[model samples]
Target: METTRYSVPFSPLQERIAREAPQLSAALNHLLQAMGASDFEKYINSLSALKKVDDHLLLITKKEMYRSVLTGRFLPVIKECFAVKFVRIVSQ
Candidate 1:
């Protein structure tokens, strides 16, 4: 008997995210470095761009503390960097 292997394809949202994640990550790293926020730079790896709505980008972090810090302090900078009118950070 021969067994067949199945592969799962990425959904449209996943595909779009996969394509844009690298650029976002790079931009975030650059911004962090430019702002001299080396202490916060490591947290970049913990963030993920979940979705893009009209003029808004949804971001998720592993912890509520990260979400709070990002929303309170970095939201404006992140919005400017991503050229978005609004950014929402959520903890998962």
Candidate 2:
């Protein structure tokens, strides 16, 4: 079997995201629900979840499975909840 590993380089931004991970996840869930995207709640829960960085919302995930699944499909909805310039999906 072959295994693919994912890693996130350490940085101040990464640390900030780590600290606010839970709160950010909750806020995102609430926002998704408020926008009548309740159906996506379950899906979002499965992924690593999101956090707001300087001018972007970073989607952190460990598994390659989700990295491929997330893409930028939710960028618009995410922007509605967060006023970031972009949404980036990165592996941790």
Candidate 3:
């Protein structure tokens, strides 16, 4: 007997997310390096840019601790780097 396989297609939003994730990571890495915070680059792998709204950017992190660190230490730098008025960091 032969088995058949079916492929699932990604929606436009899914495609946009898939495309944006790596770009977000790269952008963060570059920003961190440029700011001489290369030590923080490792954390970039755990972050994902969910979406943007008005002047704000929504970011998600894999750990709750990262949320605090990012918000407290890096929020201002991130806003400057992305030219965003606000940033919301959420943990998974």
Candidate 4:
């Protein structure tokens, strides 16, 4: 008899974030609250993924358009939530 094998799809960055910084959800919630409106919150939540690396955070996305828009519009706000060196975005 032959058996088929299946693999689980997992994201290392996300896993690391969950394991290393469980408080990230509260930080993200605070960031969202600072955005001050639902639309902005929705847009940010839809566009990127954030991972805490050492003392910094990495924001990544698959779309350059979204990355560009986010980097242009909310980079300052993100920096305010973290140190300037702690926040960054990259296309994945």
Candidate 5:
């Protein structure tokens, strides 16, 4: 079995906030709400117009980001997230 992992690059805004802030939970929550209300999904859906990705891993990566934020743990969280999110698991 070959697994392919696709890494979704974070928006510059998201990365900046995550790296610099300790309390962005509320910000993310609000941002998500705003995105939903404004039909942001359509914009997100267009990212992979050039290619297809695994939605499951995309979600896992997002969860990993939240976990990292909540725990304030770096390194492994970031590493695992990069690996899981960007590294396509291709099993042959």
Candidate 6:
């Protein structure tokens, strides 16, 4: 993969969103400690107990340490979603 450097200062949200995986993994580890042991049940309960985890882990994160690791290269995923939406419309 080709790496391009961004010259602008990154905002907290931007950085956090960027480094979601590791920050989330870290967050999950912390959450796991609260849940005690790991399993699907713990996962589900954590989701329910920590609403932000879903959105933050999957979306939000003011923590920027994980930013460099994430690539917001989900354009293809967005394109696929748009295509699927179009198909659904045509079928309807």
Task: Please give the lDDT score for candidate 4.
Answer: 0.65
Off by over 4 Å in 6: 1-20, 38-92
> Which regions in candidate 3 have their CA more than 4 angstroms from the true location?
1-18, 21-30, 35-38
Among these predicted structures, which one has the highest lDDT? 4
- In model 4, the worst 10-residue window by lDDT is 9-18
lDDT tens digits, residue span 1-92, model 2: 99999998544322343476655655565556754554354345445655677777777766665666566455566666666778787776
lDDT-based ranking: 4, 3, 1, 2, 5, 6
Task: Please give, for residues 1-92, the per-residue lDDT of candidate 1 as tens digits.
Answer: 99999987534333444467555555555556654655354444445445556678888777888888878877777777667898778888
Candidate 2 residue 51 C-alpha distance from true site, Å = 2.7
Q: Provide TM-scores for the models.
A: 0.60, 0.49, 0.60, 0.61, 0.24, 0.24
What is the lDDT, from 0 to 100, of the residue 5 in candidate 3? 100
| Top candidate, metric TM-score | 4
Error of 5 at 55 (Å): 38
Please give me the total number of clashing residue pairs in predicted model 3.
Answer: 0
Taking the tens digit of each residue's C-alpha lDDT, what string does model 4 give over 1-92? 99999986544432444576676756665667777666344455554467666667777777777678777887778777654466677877
C-alpha lDDT of candidate 5 relative to the true structure: 0.35
| 5-92: candidate 6 lDDT, tens digit per residue | 8785443332342355343344444433543453312222222122132222232223332222121332223224222221100100
- Between prediction 2 and prediction 6, which has the larger TM-score? 2
lDDT of each: 0.63, 0.59, 0.64, 0.65, 0.35, 0.30
In candidate 3, position 26 carries an lDDT of 51
Off by over 4 Å in 2: 1-27, 34-39
Which residue pairs in model 4 clash with each other? none
* TM-score winner between candidates 1 and 2: 1
